[model samples]
Target chain A: MSDLLTIENLKTYFFKKKKVIPAVDGVDLKIKKGETIALVGESGCGKSLTSLSIMRLVPKPGGEIVEGKVNLDGVDLTKLTENEMCKVRGRDVSMIFQEPMTSLNPVLTIGEQLIEVIINHQKVSRPKAREKSIELLKIVGFSRAEEIMKDFPHRLSGGMRQRVMIAIALSCNPKLLIADEPTTALDVTIQAQILELMKGLTKEFDTSILLITHDLGVVSELAERVVVMYGGQVVEEAPIDSILNNPYHPYTDGLIQSVPSLTGEIKELHTIKGNVPSPDQFPKGCRFAPRCHKAFDRCFNEHPDLKAISDSCSVRCFLYEDKQEEEEYNV
Target chain B: MSKVLEKEILEKESAGEPKQEILRVTDLKKYFPIKSGVLQKTVGHIKAVDGISFSINKGETLGIVGESGCGKSTAGRTIIRLEEPTEGKILFKGKDISHMKEKELRKQVRREIQMIFQDPYASLNPRKTLGSTIVEPLNEYNLYGNQKQRLERVGELLETVGLDSSYSNRYPHEFSGGQRQRIGIARTLALDPEVIIADEAVSALDVSIQAQVINLMQRLQEEFELTYMFISHDLSVVRHISDKVAVMYLGKIMEIADKNSLYEEPMHPYTQALLSAVPVPKKHGATQRERITLKGDIPNPANPPKGCVFCTRCPAAMDICREVQPILKTKKENHSVACHLFE
Candidate 1:
């Protein structure tokens, strides 16, 4: 399959008074048709900002995408005019936010929300749009579809609201769907249902997903590939199995180790010392060098670029840099 | 107040005898009234917590794992007397403190039971320095007399929670989320409380910071011989920190067992589904359990099911499950479950 969306060296920054903070410093990503890729990171790591950049929806008054290309189906989104980007947003790329409650308009009924998206994107009659809204609700797993359409967002549960959100996002059959922490606000059982629904819908509609979340378990269960970000930069990108089993980046390894195992003997959890640095206070060299346990003298003075160690795996750490070079020389 | 209890538990553990009970709650019920219209006449009750029973041994941790609105937080609050119980008994060291007057309770029981809230930012007073916040409890109880001693005690408590003693002078806004949580822990410890009710304490932290705080809590438990009622919605965390685990749904415990039996071979249909619902990070194509996806959302708590609260969504629900509420009964050695299948 050919690539559906490709991001190259994308940089998003926030201007505060005189200083510029690089919230998303140079991120590169790709998703093939029907592929589901997860962008995993903590709160301030710029995973959400990267997704926003792709939608041409980075917040204004301070934030802007300053560099690189977000090419979707041979079109660079950053170069598009405001009016053109608005048209491309719902028809070609749709997004679901973390809090479904806040993302939805409270006053509007579920049917109105779904119908507006359909009418905005496709040339359909009012009656036809309403029909499509009910059908979309059924596809997202609502038994009483008509009753749900009449219900307000507050009347529905968090999981139900999220399903409605997904219904609207997929109503246009966008090529790429950006879901930022889609299941984080729900219960585990409900989260399981949402994950299953997303997995099935993406496969059935042939929609590519850029799932952004901090939960590794959600990433492990649904995504085919995983991209780990830290301090506004990509630290590792690999097949889900490699990232989980044989992770090359120290930060990735620490994250995997930090999660309490469900099936093992209870031992003291491994912790990465210190906290995630704020964007304004990021280190001069490697952003992770301050808290990394395996840091050496050189790691403190130089920042490492993401280097591919194998055909399918890449890492950003001084420890992996020498190993990759030695392998290339031997080859 | 807590030192005497600590010595007793240490003696019991050293002698290899059954552990002493620190806190016990029986048939605890808390209901908030719902009213309508301008007159605001009481119509019905939202049964936040309805008749739950559990006990914690001294120096042990009881993990209460459930979904939101399952009454886990309410149970924690009621036990701490933050919310008055509608009915039932709360026993602290075999003494009923459920109906004690507020003044008497504060003088006797409040110092022994402290709570750690989830949102470290909202829970802390932003305008106050860390020193004053930690020392407020000490001043309330009039401990470590004299201003100099209280200030010194604040520094000592900060260092005990893996923070620098010098940080006592800094404000809450000056610290990170993880550091603010440590400050909360230090404040909780200032009272030398025997039983700490942590309501979703580490749920708001990042993964790495969560590990650090969990490790800190475990170490503090060892040092102070503290008993904890760790209530959270995260099962993996509960499995890691709890010696005993209770799975709750619609304000009732479906199963209660040691961590091993509960995680390895869950008995109740609700417990089975809940454990399977947790997304375990696994290698691709790894062997995993067949997930039991529940049918619908939890029913309205005000109008719970006539029988088992879980029967609406339970996969293995039978006819009897819809008519008769299953009482929690011993199913195996050291394990109890509330379900009709075993009956």
Candidate 2:
């Protein structure tokens, strides 16, 4: 089956003064129908920018999607006009942000906000939209859906607000759902609840999700496939099980090891040596080579392509690159 | 001003290990008042921390884990007297320092207990250099010798936190989040504190950086013989750094036990749900962690449920759970729970 959303060489850049800093440099990803693909990376790794690029919501003036093809449901979003893109955004792809408090309107009641989305996307009356909004609220796991419709966003807890945000996002029933760190601001229990709700909703609607987060635990639990982003590029992409158990990329390994386990005896956490290079200061060759433990001479001078290491795994590391391709490198 | 407390502090001055109980709290409560209308009449209160009791031993890390708005942060802040307690007692070295005056507390107790805030970006003054930030505490406490000695101490502190001494001249903005957290730790350690309360300290950092900070904190704890109240919502982090753990829900502790006991055999339904909810990055694939997705949101602190705070959401809640508050009591060796299930 063709992908619900396909991103090819997506590059989102920030223009500061005369310099252009690549935030989401040359990245490729494909999410099929009903697939939950997580974009895992630390802050400034361009995961958030990539999501913004897909939604065509990159901040104007300085930030822009400099280069990329964001193909959504057989149509390229990049080629769409402003008015055309606006129509496709909520109806084809909706987003859930990290902080629900700021994401939602403070003055408006929950029902007003949800109904607005419903009416804007679907050909429904105010009464029909109201009914649809209430249905969404209940679907997102609210028991007293009618009561919540009357409540303002501020009256609800962080978890409830996030749930409402999810409900609103699902109200349009977009083919693709971009949840960028939707649970980061929430507590673990609340995070679990939100992730479960998201998964359940996706199953019901047959929607694809691009779950962006820095936490691996969240990715492991919620996403089926994981794309490890580092220095504004994908370092590895594989099944969730493969990424957690046998991550090939040094950065992926570092992320996996750095996370202190909760299952058994606690061990001294292993840390990646240095900081993630600032966007402007990204290295000439491999972006992660500066901090990577096993970087050889080749890593400092040449960038490894995002090559397939196995059937279901793709890693961008010189160590896993085919030996037959080594003849093209240093003698 | 209690004679027993005075004697206890004196005894604790020369106190050794095996004589645990570095800090103890008895029936601690903190409530923020809600006011209404013209005259600003008191309209109820937000019971941030309600009648909580716990203890920490010297050189031990007591972790308090909970969801947002559950009062874990409030409890930590209240311990350092950052927020005035509405009621109850906090005994440091057997001294009830909760009611101590600011001036006296600063002299006698404040230095002994320090706090590392969650946002290192917000905690440090952006205008001040890292050197000055670390030295500010020294100046306040009047520690170290002359100007040269103080500057040297600051440099040494910078090196101890794994940052180069040369970076001391740089402002807080010049450092990364992890480095800034280290700077925060250095400032907290400046006064040679006995108990350090870190409230979501590492929650802001990246995974790899968080590890560095956690490892650094663990090493420093050993070197300084520091007792830590590591308050965080991340169970994995708390499990890694803590000797004992307390699971709190809406203004009250549902369970408290040694780290192994708490994680291994969580008795309270709330604790079990909380633990189950945490996405453990272990035994992936088919061996999925059993999850208990609780329904509804946490009740507002001002108007908690009639009986137990968790009764509204607990999966194992019984009829008694809705009518009577459960006291946190020991059920096993060093393991305690506040649930009707055990009874």
Candidate 3:
């Protein structure tokens, strides 16, 4: 599979009150064609910022992509003009936000929203766009597509609103879909439906997905690859099975152990000590060392760079230092 | 609601077992009236909690698991009398206090039952110091002795929840989400309440922080011999902390059983579907779990299905399920399911 979107040394910084906060510092990611990669982290870990930076939608005045190349196909997005980037956004790649309620406009009907996106990217007649809108609604699992088109966003449930968001994102038939906490606000049953729908739609449309979530369960269900982020850096990246079963990073291990399982005997849950530090207050050394149980003297003073342990696995920790390769793995 | 069930519980308690019922709720219902038009006349009632019954033994956690608007929160509030129950009996230590006067409640039931709110940020006063916020409860009940003793008690309470006693002087804004929640727990514990009704207590926290708080709660439950009515939408966390679990939908419990029975062999179709829908992060081949996707959203609580509340989306809903409401009945030892299929 060819790489659809590649981000190299991505750093999104927030300049607040004359202080530069490294919100997303030095992230490297590659999404293969028709593949799904999950960016997993706690709050303030810059997972959302990474996705925002990719779409060039990081809130301005304070936030900016300080450095990096967001290469989609052959074009470097960072070098593109504002006008050029606007055209590239919905046509080449689209995004789905966490809260479907706020993301959608209440005044507009579902049909209006869907058609607007379709006509915005593709030069199509209103009637044709409306026809395509209903089709998109049907594709997202709406049985009464015609009625739903006329209904406002407020009339639908959380699950239905998310489906509408998915429909609009897919209306352009973009090569890649970036869903940021797509099902976080939904109930588990609704989340399951959405996940199932996304899986089916991915296979059908052959669209690669950059799924941003704090949920390991959601990642296990949809993503083939997992990128574990902590304090604005990719601490670990590996295949889903390896990440779940045998994580290289101590943070990853602690995270997997923390979540109480549905099937297992009720045991005392393992906890990563302390809270996730604010982006500005992030430690100078390895970001996770403060909370890490296995931190050593070296882990407290020096930052460990992301080093590949194998062809498919990479980790950022002094514990895995002996196994790390001298050369970086090629995407 | 059955005499037989009450007798069985009492008989078990008398027959050498020390399982004394701390709280028992029978046919609890809370209806919020919806009035419209110029006259503001009585129009309809949003049946937020409609006839839910359960009992919690002394020092055991009874977890109430349900989706939003399923009346789980309302049920908890009504039990604690935060919200007045429209119709039902709330028995604390085998005495019905559902219609008790506010003054009497403060003197009797209020001191024994405390509630920990979900949003740690909204629940506490931003302007107040952590000491004052916790000590306010002590002041209300006229607990401890002088100002010095109260402040000392406040410091002790903070230390109990794993926060430094020195943090009592700090404001709520100075603490993180987890730290703020610990403060909230401290406030709840200041009264030395026997039953703590925690509503979505850990839902707002990150996974790691959530585990820390959960562990803290467990340790406190043991230390204080505290009975908990832990209400949350998160099934896994509920299963982990609860001795018995109740699954609610559309203002009624679909199933109530031991965590093992409910999680492993859920009798109600709704319970089964809800469990299956939860995505588990397990090793490959460890989970070949069949997901039961329920159709449509929860029916409007104001006008829930005339038949079964869950009939609208129940995957295995029968013809009878559409015409008649299923009453909750014990189908097995210590397991109760409210589905017609069990009959």
Candidate 4:
């Protein structure tokens, strides 16, 4: 199958006051059909912005998608009208937000919310939509679907609320699902359950998922391909094994080293010193050079392109520039 | 494992004569009455902590692991008397301070059992400097009469947590999440409390910072001869830091055991499912392991399942599990499980 979603040099900017804040600057992404791609980064690194840009739902007032093409099956989503994009949202692509408690409507019943999505996207009556909602709830492993449907969002637990969010996202069975920090607010056990449920449901439906999270464990468990982002740019993209085993970019390396492992005793987790830079004050050369251990004069002076390293791995670092010159590597 | 064995040897020497107990909580319950409708009468209650019992030795970490709304935070808060418990006996050094007057408790037991809150950002007052925040406990308990001594103590405390003393003048916002947590730790240690209840102290921090905080806590626990009630949702962090682990669900203890045993051979089906779901960061694919995907979400704690709270989602749940609530029964030494399977 062709690429489910292809984003090339997508730039999302926020016109705060008068100054422009480039949140997602020149981001490139590709999601294959029935594949799971993880967008890994620290907070404020523009991973969430990329997802928001894909859904054409950048926060109002200041934020807008300024440049780049979001191609879904050869259709440029960025060029579409608001009504046209609305049609594409639930039917062609859907999104699961970060916090389930706030994402879900407090006053509305779970069944009402789920059915509303179905009724809005598809030509279905209320009764038919309600039936579909119940079926979707059951599909997401919510037993006692009838009872849960009647319950309001506040009445359910955190995990249950997240499940409802997933059910709503998957109500129309969109080909692609973009989950942004889906389990960040959840506890580990509940997070595991939700991750398993998402993986199972997505596999069952043969739906592609773009899992955005900072947790490497989740990526290792769920993702087939990994896209590591730093300072609003894709620093590294590779197969899961390659990224985990032999990450090329310094940022990806730092991320891997930082995650506390279950097997061995972690004496000292390697921390990337300094906070993620604000969008307005990005460095001139390598955005990661300020915190990278492998930074040199050359790295500080020049920005590196996303160069292909191997058949399965690509990295945006000066260290891998020789590999591309030696071998003609193509995706 | 060898390091653990060696640590145990060192603990025996450092612990000296085993004191009878440092802190004991019996049938601790914290219920918040929910009022609704036109009348605003007490319609129901949110039983955040419901009838839980545990004890802490003089110098050991007792980890409480549970999902959100499982009452782990409430249990810790109630133990520290931050939120008054509905019912329970908080026996400190054999003295039941449960019914002690607020003034009396604040004078005696409050300083002895300090608590670290979850959000470091909200915990520390923005107006106060790090020095003042840490020194407030010293002033409250009258540990130091002079300002110089208090400043010295604050500096020492900062040094203990691997932070520079120069950060004393910095406000909460000036520091990172890890640095702020260190300041919180320093404040908690100012009273030189016998028992410290760390309620998700490092959960808000990044993974790398979490490790640093955990290491600092372990070191401080050893140095201060402190007993800790470490409450957290991250099982891996809990397992690494805790000597004993208690698994809670719906404001009740599901299982409690030694850290190794709990992870290696979990008895309760909920524990099993929880353990299986934890993504192991090894080369071996987790897919090979049979993950018990609990069918339903956690039941509402306000009105939990009739018999067992876990029965709603438990895979090995039988009719007995649905008919009767299981009590915590000791299956082995230092191990207790609340499930019909054990019976």
> Whose DockQ is greatest here?
1
DockQ of each: 0.79, 0.69, 0.78, 0.43
Model 3, range A127-174, lDDT digits (tens) per residue? 999999999999999999999999999899999999999999999999
Per-candidate clashes, comma-separated: 0, 0, 0, 0
Local lDDT at A2 for model 1: 100
Error of 4 at B182 (Å): 2.7
- Window of ten residues with lowest summed lDDT in model 2 chain A: A322-331
Candidate 1, A1-331: lDDT as tens digits: 9999999999999999999999999999999999999999888999999999998888998999999999999999999999999999889999999998898999999999999999988999999999999999999899999999999999999999999999999999999999999999999999999999999977798999999999999998889999999999999999999999998888999999999987787679999999999999998778999999899988889999998898888888889877898879988
User: How much lDDT does candidate 3 score?
Assistant: 0.93
TM-score of the second chain, each candidate in turn, equals: 0.95, 0.95, 0.95, 0.92
Deviation (Å) of A284 in candidate 4 = 4.7
For residues A1-331, could you state the per-residue lDDT of candidate 2 as single tens digits? 5688989999999999999898889999999999999999888898998999998999988998878899998899999999999899889999999999899999999999999999898999999999998998889888899999999998988999999999999888889999999988887778888888887877789999999988888887778899999989999999998888888998999988898877767569999998988899999789999998899999999988998766688889998876425533533
lDDT (Cα, tens digit) per residue for candidate 4, span B1-343:
9989987876686578665477888999999999998999999998889999988888889999987789999898887777888998988877898788999998889888989888988999999899988888788777877989999999998998888988899889877778889889998888888999999998898765676687788888889888889998888888888888999999999999988888778898988887777776545453456666666556777898889889988878899989999999889888899999888
The candidate that achieves the highest TM-score relative to the unseen native structure: 1
Model 3: CA > 4 A from native = A325-331, B1-16
Error of 1 at A183 (Å): 0.4
Q: Which one wins by TM-score: 1 or 2?
A: 1
Error of 2 at A95 (Å): 0.9
Best first by DockQ, ranked: 1, 3, 2, 4
Return model 2's CA RMSD, one decimal. 2.8
Better of 2 and 3 by TM-score: 3
Q: Indicate whether candidate 2 or candidate 4 has the larger TM-score.
A: 2
Chain B global fold similarity (TM-score) for predicted model 3 against the true chain B: 0.95
